[model samples]
Target chain A: MTADDPVRDSLERFIGKPMGEGAVAPEEVNLPMIRHWVDALDDRNPIYLDEAVAAETRMGGVVAPPAMLQTWTMPSPVIAGIAERGGAPTAMKSENVVTALDAAGYVGTLATNSELEFERYLRVGDRLKTTSALESISPRKRTGLGLGYFVTWITTYWAGEDEIVGRQLFRIFKFDPSTMGGAA
Target chain B: MSAGTIHVGDELPVFELPVTSTVIVAGAIASRDFMPAHHDSEYARGQGAPDMFMNILTTNGYVSKFITDWAGPEAMVKKIAIRLGGPAIPGQPLRFSGQVIAAEDKNDERVFEVTIRAANDLGDHATGTVVVSLPLEPSS
Candidate 1:
């Protein structure tokens, strides 16, 4: 059996569970911040650049680009087991397959697929509450060509009075490049 | 935005990084993320940019570590969101940093509001908000 195979609970338990939630505190977003994200992606979507142009569209005031929220970081205090509590890890027991591969000494990995869903446009001042859940964890299967592993996490983002976004799902594969990709 | 762990308008320790592709890939491996946009410059540039771009998850890692590093590992990152403004190209210098804006205590959690950005020569490429839970320091 491949090391990617599930050993304990399904890999689903190892990642993507909700940590907690917070609020936007009303009218909190500053337009400049929105512009910063837009400029970074180099996306020429005019609605984001010009407010009048943005108003012409359904979303008002240069709404945040769908993928923007995913790029930001969460409030994680560096010290462990001191200031806070770990209710449940976004990760599960079986989800360790990927980490396990590295632990067991597997060398390389490859990415296979990803899916993201945007339920509503993220507004500037809207209060956002993010809730997450572990989606799935599949055992790493050894293919005739090589070996790889896969896992997914589901996050639901909510804004004040609206369900703004849903599901940022990610997946990956691991293999010895020397055997498959022919690399050192 | 808060007097907790940070004051309003303080530039953080630039999420302390070279923002390298290795860091990006480490995040992908941790999450088992496989998106052509993250790993392949060819696929990434085919869509846009001069080369492959860092994944949002990797960006999040730096961002997460940035604050957590300050708050200490024990702190919990309740929620975070980033808006991708520019691409974090591989082999270039980038900064992951932010400032505290507000603080609240709810359900025994010391909630902090922070505005963070990943800045580079290209200007700020990413910006977002963070909500963290931290331990309280005993009054002297």
Candidate 2:
């Protein structure tokens, strides 16, 4: 697809716009969630759990796993009939780029890349809020699965109203499965 | 290891993760991702996946553990950038491997960039770089 393609033109308007109102984590950074992750992943990193051991290190105290930055702001799941909802933790909004792509017949989704940057280790009591903005959308291209467009977005994690703690760039390919193996 | 001791081309010890349904589900719930593909095998198969697979958040969690286990507690991760490929499904053992590709000193810290790859029989699950830093002087 070219830049002039109506679908592409429509998506272009979303670039640099906030995906939604954004979200605030329902809970602050706390030990229970940290410990659950530590056990689940078997991370065994002392700084993540052992206060005494963590205190002796340069970190000076316990810290949440750096990778958990994204986990903190994940929406709480409404378990009832989640599978019926196609695994969406909650109801999805209707006007975002994702919904737009679905409406445009590009329904298949595959994550392609992730880039996470952390400004500092999150300590207990730090509450995080997230604001995600659409970054870019590639012109449609043919792939093994089908014809697709790559959509990229950046989510900024804030510790408070002003302090940015981390950021993540997430990209995914949205394709039309029906177009698989059609004309190149 | 201390920042002073790190060098480019250094290889971190290999860490292996035994992927299983429990592992996948645990990581998903812990990460607050309710994606059925990470838990319900039937739903995943219905969606054309071979089986339930690990989520990205779980993959990043393991990746962080793999790096910090080698770099130790003093090392604070600055960045983790990875290209996602293939499914991390049950019974496939994902082997974690990495090598320090670049090292530099800036102000009071030494930063190192490490190239990492996590793979299983199906293929490479993730491949990319992680940036971590350590204080030039140990705090204690």
Candidate 2: lDDT of A182? 99
lDDT of 1 by residue, A130-174 (tens): 565556656645653365554454556566566655455555555
Q: How close to the true structure is residue A46 of candidate 2, measured as C-alpha lDDT?
A: 95
lDDT of 2 by residue, A1-184 (tens): 3645788888877899998778899999999999999999999989988999999998889999999999999988889988988787888865889889989999899999999999999999999999999999998899999998999999999998999999999999999999999996
Q: Give the candidate number with the greatest TM-score.
A: 2
What lDDT score is found at residue A114 in candidate 1?
Answer: 38
Task: At residue A8, give the lDDT of candidate 1.
Answer: 27
Candidate 2 lDDT score at position A48: 89
Listed models, DockQ each = 0.03, 0.90
Whose lDDT is greatest here? 2
- Model 2, B26-74: lDDT tens per residue? 9998998988999999999999999999999999999999999998889
The segments of candidate 2 whose C-alpha lies over 4 angstroms from its true place after superposition are: A1-4
Cα lDDT for residue A8, candidate 2: 82
